[model samples]
Target chain A: MNINILYAALAPIVAILLGLLYIGIGRKIIARLQRRYGPPFYQQYIDTIKLLAKKTVSSHGVFFSLGPIMGLAGSMVTLLFIPFGSAAPLLSFHGDIILVMYLVVIAPLGMALGVGEGSNPNGSIGMARGLTLMLAYEVPFVLALFSVVLYTHTTSIAQIVQSQAGEWSLLKFHGFNWLTFALPISAIVADICLQGMLGEKPFDQVIAPHEIASGPMVEYGGKYLGMMVINHALHIYIETALFVDIFLGGGPVWFFIPATFSVFILSLIINGVLPRFRIGQALKFYWGVPLILAVIGIIYTMVVIK
Target chain B: MKQKTEQKKSLNQGGKNMTEEKSIDFFEYFIGPQHPGITGNFGVILNAVGDEIIKAQANPGYLHRAFEKLMEQRMYLQNVPLVCRICVPEPDVNEALYSMAIETLTGIEVPERAKYIRTIVLEMARLAAYLFYFGGTAATLGLYTLPNWSFGDRDYILDLFEELTGARIYHIYMQPGGVRRDLPKDFTKKLYSLLQTLKKRIKEYDGIFFDAALFKKRTKGVGVINKDMAIEYSVTGPNLRASGIAYDIRKDTPYLAYPDINFNVITENEGDFYSRVMVRRREFEEDIKILEQLIDKLPSGEVWNRYPMPLNWKVEKGDVYVKVESTKGEYGYYVVSDGSEKPRRIHVRGPSMTHGIMLLEKLLKGQRIADISPIMFSLDICPPDIDR
Candidate 1:
């Protein structure tokens, strides 16, 4: 019980640090692509520490002060619920997939509540865009999730990972029994949804600096902004790790780290080249292409299950 | 308490019935003078509902240095440095236009070689400005790679300028009678190589930025100025050409060595933000061809014609409006001289005076808030030009 308690304590710290490292490395990759000598891979760690160390922090009210805390708390809770690999399902329960989904939303909602109290139109608009974007991407994402759950006959994330473990005889795919190969269409749809969830262009409208001035975090500064940065790092880990667990066969740590980092780097490469879509355009895209693909994937899953 | 009751009564009476009335809450915010997204030290007061802009007012004067009024207090030569500061990105246009105005009023005919040299300087400035436009427009749309590439490429042009004029940004090279100095040794060879490098790099820009589907989808038809509207607003340069109007000051009024050089006035019919940007993109190539031709035909003679003694020079009483085709638009200088060392009055007609204020305000109405920066950049509205 003490070892389990210690593992629970260690999981979030490891996740946050690894997430920051991925972001810093992603920045370096984008810089190299653009012919620039980017900052060191630990630049995010330095930035977070510097921001947290700053003394002055302005607040609009109780909600303003509570916003970053709530966001950090929400991301922490979401991270705890999602299993990172085979060895570490920190706080995962039998029906935690549904709980994880609900928890994933709390961070942005908390952010909205806090930014609303700040009385900034940019922040409000950012929150609105973010929520609207959430609504758009969630449709396809939920459909993909449903397909994965139905194919494996489980709502428990651990069972889902166990289901993807053994090899299939009909397809005779050898090395890894990841669902990405078994349910290819659903996996593709989920990856597209992941692009939106990650907030990389051509879908990065929420914090479009040129459009609305960094959106929800426009007025946040000092420690509040620092917390948001930490929350963002954790948020990245949670979203990508969830994808890995569902599609990539939540293997040991060796497999999990590379799989997650590759997924993130793919998004970063796309982000470096593409311009942002307008909010309306983003909605239209999510509803049109990925939505139809998601519907087809669910139908395929249903047919295969029968 | 009475005022509150009166306000409530007025609100109720303004509509026929409360159930039939709808109130829109406009979110008003200022987008710079301190914001990063803005092009320069400029501001746009945006009144928006949701993500759509209901109204946008161009808030100029943040970078106002009263350049026109200051020119009145200085001599013709003294104002050359001051005028260049009016437009930061492409300062050579100001120097050329100011010198052209003074030369015309004083009737100081520049030498044959000087005209060629001036033409070379002007085209180089235009090329540099277009490079800046590519980086800035791409950055506003969030394709950060193009900015890194194009801005790095622009430094090559600035290096050439520095070698010639002893300054990188504000090169006060164009003097009243002619250029301040002749071309340095092997300058043409270096320019030819730079053009070769740019020709190769432009394809990379096309691969990443200009031909990218997302860039096209974002910019096409976003900030359109139809030909009729373009003419009504007196839009000039690449913007005017983009609207299918083939009006080019370089072609219509042959200045410097343009009459001898062979180049087409690049135009696009769509008149949208994409067309505006494409016009400049094609014009970059056209400018390269013009510079190559100028170097091939550069004559060997004096670059500067001797004027009257400095610090006591006087001009003949006259007024003249000399205009040049800058990268943005028709940059004109109206100089009225009462035959004095300092002119009686001078008026600078920067292209941003029309494009940045009236055209920008008109284009921004009903546009999504996301498009504000991209449209401003597409029009190439340098704020200092407007403020000055």
Candidate 2:
């Protein structure tokens, strides 16, 4: 019982720390890819702590404060369901994969809504752009996610991981077939595109400083801006972790460090190389090419795996 | 959900116009000050009837810094650095125009080497400024990669400026009689190579952004202006060139070393946003060619004039209005000298005041909200010039 209590308490702390680590490492790798000296590994943590200690300032409405809180809550909620180190999740339940996906979206959605409630026209425009981007990237992401479930034959994330363990790992289970491999590759591309939509460099259209001067976050200042920084770090962390869990098997303790670093470096390389897609183009990609590929992957899985 | 639907319906229906008599509803829309379509810190309050803009009032001075008023208080020499701030992007033109005005007033002839160097600097500045214009125009059409590429390349040119002028954005090197320093060893050779590399890369830009079908559709016939209206409104640079005007200050009134350099004035007869973009596109080639020619013909001579010391120097009591073909348009400075350390009066005539404000307002009228941004970009008007 005491062990269970400790697990409950430490689970959030460990998961949150991992989330923070993911952001720190991801930033460093992206910086390196862009030929820059990225921030130190603890940069995200320091930023978060700094934000929490500062005073919050709001321009238009109380919803601005509520937005970052909701983002934090979404991260915390996702952290609860995702299993760590073969341990049982803090709040595991049936159909939690869908909940995890929905939670991934909640942070940006809340931030967009809160920014739209502001009086600034630029802020509203930025929010509108962000929403358009959300619409563009989300559908392909959902389809890609469902393909993983179809292959594993379960919606429970832990069971999916368990299915990938050892000799029965999808790579080995499918004899490392090139035809089967296309599913994850397509999913990975979709994830990278989605990450761009999530507001990193190159595809940072919503908050393009030269064009709109930080866009939706333009009106936010002081501690409210600080919370935004923390929220962004958490969002990146969760997204990176989701990629790791989906494509990469939840491997042993020794593999975590290298796997984390490798996945992070891949994301950074992608971010550094590409330029942003306009909202319209992004919509076309998500609804058009990626959707077709995702359907193909799902149909292939249904026919072959069963 | 039901209540939200009802609220949305009421808002769209104007709260009760359908069930009763037709109310006089003159739709007034505030188009900017912070709208995505507006270029800088400025707004347009428009009263429209359907798709046509009936009444338009420009609420400029959003980025006003009172630069003309500020210049009146500074010394004639002190005004050099300050003038560069007037148009932040292509600052070399400001420096050149001001210096030429001072030279005219003082009756000082610049050294031949300094003249060539100034010409080179001016061309490079124009290229840099046009690169920025191309980037903005591409972005407005939702073609995003070109901006990333252009901005990255422009920084390389800024490095050259830092080496020559000891300042990146505003160079105070161009003074009354000549330049501050001579050319670095092999400067022309290096410039030639960079131009070669740029020529190769431009084709890539043409492939990705310029020739893309969507951009073609968006920009082709939008924001059209003929030569008559362009001349009447005092529009200049590529904006004027787009209206089929063959006039260029370099050709019409040859200043500095332009009489020695052979180059054609690029113009397009389309008189539309696409034509404006195309003019800049062709001008980018012309600027590179001019730079290459200037580099090859550079004569060996002293760069600076043996002018008197700064403290005792005074100009002859005279007036001169010198105009230069800047990246944007005709950048002119009119000076009145009373033979003191400072001038009695100085006036800057920047194209952006005509193009960004007056011309932009006129061109934007009756245009769709979508076309507004690309039209502003194609005009290539710098906001600081308008504000100054």
Candidate 3:
């Protein structure tokens, strides 16, 4: 129990560091692609440190103070529920995938509540768009999640990861057992939903800098923004790790690192080139294409199970 | 309860049904001089519901420096330095237009070589401005890679300007009778190589930004100004051409070395944000073609004719309006001289007077809040031009 507590405490710190590193590297890659010298890889760490060390931070009320704390808490809680690798299922329980899914939403909800208290129109607009986007991507995301759960016949994230460890006869051409190969349709749908979930363009309307002045974070500053940065880092790690655990067959630390980093870099590459979709267009796209694909994947999974 | 009833009664009397509850739904915000999304020191006061803008009011004068009034006090030659301050992006156009106005009023003929050089400088400025436009428009749409590419490329043009004119932004090159000096050694060769580099880079730009499907989806049919609306708004330059009007001041009026150079006025019929951007994109190529022709046909003569002593240079008592096709639109300088060392009055007609103010306000109505910046950038509304 003490070891588990220590692991739980260590996991969020590691996730934050990894997420920050990912963002820094992503920025460097994007900069090189644009033919410019980007900031150092540790730039985000410096920024977060500077923000946290700042003396004064204006507050909007009790809720405003609570927002970033809540967001950080939510991300930390979600990270704990998921298995980091095959060894570190720190706080997992039966049916924790459903719990993790619901817990993942608390960060944005906390942000919405906090930004609502701040009462800036841009922040409000950002909150609205972020929630609307959540609604849009959730349909396909849930379908994809359900397809995986049904195929593996498990709701615990640890069991699901364990189930995809070895070779399976179905679509075992290369002796691959990852769901990405087994349920290719669901994997693609989930990857598409991941793009939206990560808030990369062309679905980056929630924090579109040019459009709504970075939306929900418009009014946040000092420690509030600093906390958000940490929350964001952990969020990135959680989302990518979740994708990896479900589809890529979560293994040891070495495999997990490269698999999650590659998934993030793929999204980053897509983010670098595409212009943002308007909120309406993004909704239409998520509903029209990925939703249909997710449904098809689910039907295929059910038929395979039968 | 009483105040609510009064508010409801007044709202009902205005026209449409608007309850106190419903009226409060309209969220008003200022996208301003401090905002990153905004271009320059400009602001737009928008009344919106959710993300859709209901009304937009152009808020100008943030970067205002009373140039016209300042010009009234300075001598003809002294104002040369002052005129370029009106427009920061394409300062050469202001200097050329101001000089041309004085030249017309004083009857001091500019040398043929000086005219060609001025045209070359103007075209280079246009190319630089278009490059800036690409960066700004792409950035507003959240595709930041193009900005880094275009801005880095723009430095080459600025390098060429620095060699000839001794400054990157505000050159103050054009004098009343001619340019400040002749071209530097191997300047054309350097310029030619830069153009070639740019020409090669344009394909890469097209691949990344111009031809991106999402860029088209975001920009196409957004902020569309029909041909009739274009005419009504008095939109000129690439914007007017984009709206199906093939009229170009350079082609129609035949200014400077334009008569000698062969080029087509690039136009598009869509008149939307996409076409406006496309019109500028194609015009960048046209500008390159014009520069190439000007370089080939550059005459051998004195680049400047010596004007009178700077302190005592007097002009004839007459008014003249000299206009040039700037990268933005028709930039005109209306100068009235009272035969004194100091001119009587000077009026600068920057294109942003229409584009930034009235036209921007009209175009922004019913547009999504996300499109505000892109639309503003596509219009190429420089706040300094409006504020000047």
Candidate 4:
């Protein structure tokens, strides 16, 4: 029940395992889409280990070192907050969803800090872009989060998941049923928008290799780059876990296997199928379409239930 | 309000302050040497009134490799790889132009098929380089998605080049008297299919990227170079053609197989940043047309001549200047041979040296800071051209 000790004990191992699984499935899906063989599930683990074992070089600042550490910490926090397979979460408290929101944001903030501290103007520009993207997506995301919390009449994610066990909370509650459809749709859109903000292709605007020469990563080399890579992998892992827990509740006994793997495959398939969105277009989609969807979901829940 | 002092000073000083007060304001910024907005390793000292650039002075020679001087010291055969480095984006043009100059000087008539092969390679390079233009231009306008799409698509072209020339980017495949090898079986079919694929993609690209509101907002009328200014600056290629000058070296001079092909000299009436980008976009379509025709009418002959094994070959004492309307502009190579295997003097008068450096400096002055990249991309300056 004590949060700190529980997180200290299980966070790194679970996070690392989930990170590897996520990367493994992601690589497989991307490979399939590109018509090639994806790497083994543990390839990312091997890569991280090799990078960490190598000598580190610093061209910029202490933030370069701090970025990955904080990113990993942020991901761990997100992982700890999620209800794994049962009703109990690793960390539980009233209004903890707010904590989760802030916790999820820390990775990008840490990354932006690290890149800005690296003193490469490209990195700074990329940080600015990443920050702007956070602004665009986070507002609607938080609003959607509030809508879900409102429907359940509880801020505890465990309670919400438990409520779903009987008849699926989304459908069990008659008045808030529309909130379920709307929230998931908005969440998926938000996540897709955030993925680009996370610097994947099509949305890899901040560090376009040829244009800004890898943007914020332009000056990074050796182990510093390795840490950034690990940080990103972990971030994706935690974000997907959160998505699974919120939208696609833990299914049958083998649900975690399929649910977790499916999310990774979906993300990769999305990455392969779509090109990047421009900054303005991205902002417009997140703030415009996703915001409208979140509003409709909230309105449907309020009018139907309470 | 600040004009009062200036008016008083001008009146007191007999109206001479306009010409005499040429010093830059103390808050001037020099964005180059290692700065954004520049095409490559060069600098421009800017006198800015806030974000507005009041004056811009061109600074060159950072990437300057003394290529002409380097060319003079190398033997004719040894210079093949050396010349290709002159204009990195369109390196094949350098090889073609240099070899054409050598051919003209030595009176070695290349086989008809080799000429066609050379023409295809040159046009492909032009297409690839224009794709690069789309990337750079789109990025300049903050439509970052266009660059990603264009660059990803560009790899397809590079894939073709890799298969054909055994190297991507700098294909040192074009040699004197012809190409290094004959076209592989079904090379024309594959090329045709690739062109068709590129054509379909271009339409989608036009809808999503080039025709977007942001592109229009950033580029339209931002940097307008009229026909007079274009002529005065000696701007060529798309920039010159955009200003309504229909002077294309391929059409005007008709070197290699350009004379045999039926392609129009694409011209735009407006010489602004948008017009320049439009001209290149139109030219991409034109390049597809040229490639289609080249494949249809390709002649049958030897791809190359023995040419005395290159290193052993010698040119009689003579001077010649060969010009080709490359993707950029008038790519001219002037060579003076003293009846030796090596040339006595070689000068690469690439268009970028004038357009990228001199004309860029002139146009960038009095423009806003955001306008810098689009204008630079509009000129399509291959930085290596200036370095050479």
Q: Pick the candidate with the highest lDDT.
A: 3
Q: What does candidate 4 score in Cα RMSD to the true structure?
A: 8.7
TM-score of chain B of each: 0.94, 0.90, 0.94, 0.92
Which pairs of residues clash in candidate 4, taking residues 3 or more apart in a chain or in different chains? A123-A216, A164-A169, A202-A276
Flag the better candidate by lDDT, 3 or 4.
3
Show how many residue pairs clash in every candidate, following the order shown: 0, 0, 0, 3
Model 3: CA > 4 A from native: A167-175, B1-24
Model 1 local distance difference test score? 0.87
TM-score, one value per model:
0.94, 0.78, 0.95, 0.76
CAPRI level of candidate 4 = incorrect
Ranking by lDDT: 3, 1, 4, 2
On lDDT, the stronger of 1 and 3 is 3
Off by over 4 Å in 1: A166-175, B1-23
lDDT of 1 by residue, B218-326 (tens): 9998899998999899999999999999989999998989999999989999999999999999999989999999999999989899899868999999999999999
lDDT by residue (B131-219, candidate 2, tens digit) is 78877777665444577678767877887888888988788779878898887777787788889988987887787667766566657
DockQ of 3: 0.54
lDDT of 1 at B114: 93
The model with the greater TM-score, 3 or 4, is 3
Residue B231, candidate 4: C-alpha displacement in angstroms: 4.3
TM-score for the first chain in candidate 3 comes to 0.96
Query: How well is each residue in A62-134 modelled by candidate 4, as lDDT tens digits?
Result: 7777876676677766777877644466678887778888888888787777776665444655566677777
TM-score of chain A of each: 0.95, 0.84, 0.96, 0.84
Docking class of 3: medium
